[model samples]
Target: MEENDVLVTVEGLSKKFCKDLKTSLWYGIKDLISNIQGNKNERLLRPKEFWAVKDISFELRRGECLGLIGHNGAGKSTLLKILNGLLMPDAGKVTIKGRVGALIELGAGFNPILSGRENIYNNGAVLGFTKQEINSKLEDIIDFAEIREFIDMPVQNYSSGMKVRLGFAVAAQMEPDVLIIDEVLAVGDLGFIMKCFKTIDNLLDNTAIIYVSHNMPTVSRLCDKIILMEKGQSLFQGNQVGKAIDMYYGSFVENESNIVFTNGSIELLTIDLLSSLKMNDNIHEIKWKDDLLLYFKFKLNLYIDIPIFRVLLYDKEQRPLAIFEPNYDENLLKNNNGFLEFTIKHEGIQLSKGIYSINVTAFKRNSNEPILRINNVLSFQIIHDEDHFQPFLLSSTFSTK
Candidate 1:
């Protein structure tokens, strides 16, 4: 694509956040005291200059969808804010050619006290639509939101999902030149999400999409290119969406130590996949009968009590499918040097083919509560196969809908 085809250009963009600058009880108290004393000096110490996005630069071509992937604190949201003019960068230039509409945070622009119908008009106004324009689009927005009965009700009365639906309807109907979305797809049911995706796909021709999500497979499917962020810097930018995802997760797990088990307690230190294992890996691998071992190393911290290590699997919808916590004898684990291992046998793993997360919990002998617990330890996938599975083999065919 020619350089002139670029619709969004970001150069040396950076953002900073400060722990001290956060709004806390102490900060609120300090601000109150400062106001009382008329002390302007304390305001100087409020803190800025902590870059959340550091020297990040990239160009997004027209009609191209760019995915942003990163860990929680990474500058994904910060960069999105800058691109949408919600937040200005500390030291960089961002140039955009078209009218931008965003679905960043759910209900970000809605007034709680206002009726849903009123909020739509308010948001439409902010997007440069006049009253007549909003009036013309009101019926369309209401139809898309599927909130006909409650449109006149106060927004505070709406559920979170309803709020998202209304907010998305307003933005989507605006027909902006660019769209920025951040994980709002995570809300609502699967059917609703699919409808929204279909709507956006139909509008993709004239719009450059900037999407931020932790769901790597979805990103790979929808985005033409991907950008990986870690800490405050862009780690990778490439068309090979898979490579960017691998680098992003690889960077994520680097600092964490693998699990170690000792005594009678097993501690799952690190849960990572083989080089072949990726976020985009098939969902069949996550099934009950998959050959791939969930390689986990646990440590028995103390031998005073028996330990039971459990692996729980949940589907993409976060519904618990199966649980395995084979209890081993105290004598079975003699060494406490952190080299104990456990495997979830493939005999009875029953899950439909889709993405799943593994949650780990360790319980002590006869104790109702777990001594060590970690939620969402790892995630894996299962793939579709033409052959109907043998009894012990994982099933291939499953539908996302």
Candidate 2:
């Protein structure tokens, strides 16, 4: 791409923060004096100072979207703030070719005491829009936000969702050259979020965007380039969005088993993934079409007839995606020498490529009461060539004329 095509450019961008307020003030005074004396050293870290963002660089061309993803406090927000001109980088520079619109934080650009209507005009003027332009887009913004009735109300009274909706509507409707969005969109309801995404899709053709989010599906849907960050450093940056997403998912520490409810009659001795290959003691790796087998051993304190066992699969977000319940068979539930041992086998697993966790529940046959309910008993990953947003990857035939 030509240089002129690039709408946003960042080079060696770095920012640091001091952990102690008193120390920070002292350092600030010293730095000011050093700069006045023409001997400032911005790169050196003082005591209690840490780099929040360090040496991160990327270029955004018009019509391209970059996904900035990481765990909380990974400096994604700090990078966005620098790009949006909310904060200046101590060691690098950022250049933008056009007007920038940002919704980095909920109610960030709004005056809390001002009505939404007045704030809209203020934000528009900040973006260099004339009164005529703001008037032309006012109705569209109010309608898109779905807050027409509350447009005249003070912004401080708006709920988080309301603020997100209004903030996004104003930012998106103005259609600035560079748009920066943070995870504030996660606060909106599902319906409004869909609407906001549709607006983003429409805006992509004429704008360059920097989107920071933890929702992998949305990132996969929108971003053409991905950057994986950890500890304020970019661990991976490339067009291999799927691989970047995998790394992000890999960084998550498996949740420890949380027993929601349990009876004294049953004790879970061990649960293991019966696999030839293992990622670690806690995680197993398998191909997409491979059979998944889970072995369970439970000590039976009291002999209960026909105990029912259930296995639930959950995505990385902890949303339950699938459930497995074996057919009723008295022989399968029988106690073997004071212990219950069995294997739950899933033939040709159809789940899409991603990390998943297992949840197990045991109950008395035909009873609603659970003998044991446990979460995050086991975790696993399915390797696949392609990433999918849906939970299942079913086999289907395709044809074209």
Candidate 3:
């Protein structure tokens, strides 16, 4: 796009926030005093102050869609509010051309006691729409919102989904030159989401859009470019949506907690879950398709003639994801009087890049009854890899010494 076609330009944008309320009030009072005294010095943060948004820059041209993605409190909302002129930046400049339609927060400009129809007028006036213009689009807005039945009803009685639908419909139908949307669409019903996407698809020809959503799939589908934010800074920005998503999901793998149960029929001794770039070298993490290992020790309470071993895998929601039977057919446990050892080695562990529960269980030969079941006794994660095998061996001796 040409320079003249650039609709939004942000340069060195920064915003600061106090971490404590008392300190913030004090700073405000002190700053007010300083202003009265004409101090005219540089503004600096005092104790317990922090930057909510550091230096960040980006641009959007006509007919372009830019996506802002990050975890909560990553300064995306602050940036959007600044772009829409609702808030001022502490430093740097934001130049946005043409009329802007912002559906920032769900029911942000709306009154609870006001009817939906009345809210439509109030919001339109707030967004700089004339009475005749709002009247022209009134039927289309109501039709698009699918809230005709609730048009005269007070919005305080509306459900969250209903509010989202009405708010989106008004913001979309007003025909602004630039559209800025936060994560409010996440609360919309599926049908309304489809309708809104269709409307947005139609608007892309003439409007510039800034979208912020944690829904990666949708962002990948809609945005021409994506910017990743971390700790209030612009960490990455590019056109490779898949690569960006990989980094996004990979950042979350190491922070999961492991849950183990020792009171079951089988008592787990120790579990070893590691990933590496090569064999026998233990690294805390590795890229996709790196060497992996899963090893553990457990004891059998009672003596069994022949026992079969199994491992059950589950997701964070406690739903079963996959199961592995390692020493089921082979008679690897000739001596079952003491502790048993298990080892699973693979060139690259295959998983969808998330934490999963690794459960170990056992059963007697020629019987459906499980001799032991260890539920969620082990867990592991795949940063980005997938494929392996099953390996489990029974140990012969048991002694703490």
Best by TM-score: 2
10 residues in a row with least lDDT, candidate 3 = 386-395
- The TM-score measured for candidate 2 stands at 0.90
Tens digit of lDDT per residue, candidate 1, span 167-224?
7787777676778988887888787788889988886777888999987667867888
Report the lDDT of model 3 for residue 151.
97
Q: What's the TM-score of every candidate structure?
A: 0.62, 0.90, 0.71
What does candidate 2's lDDT look like per residue over 159-204, in tens digits? 9899888877777766678888887778889999898888889988
Using lDDT as the yardstick, the better of models 1 and 3 is: 3
Q: Per lDDT, what order, best first? A: 2, 3, 1
Best candidate, lDDT: 2
> In candidate 2, where is summed lDDT lowest over 10 consecutive residues?
275-284
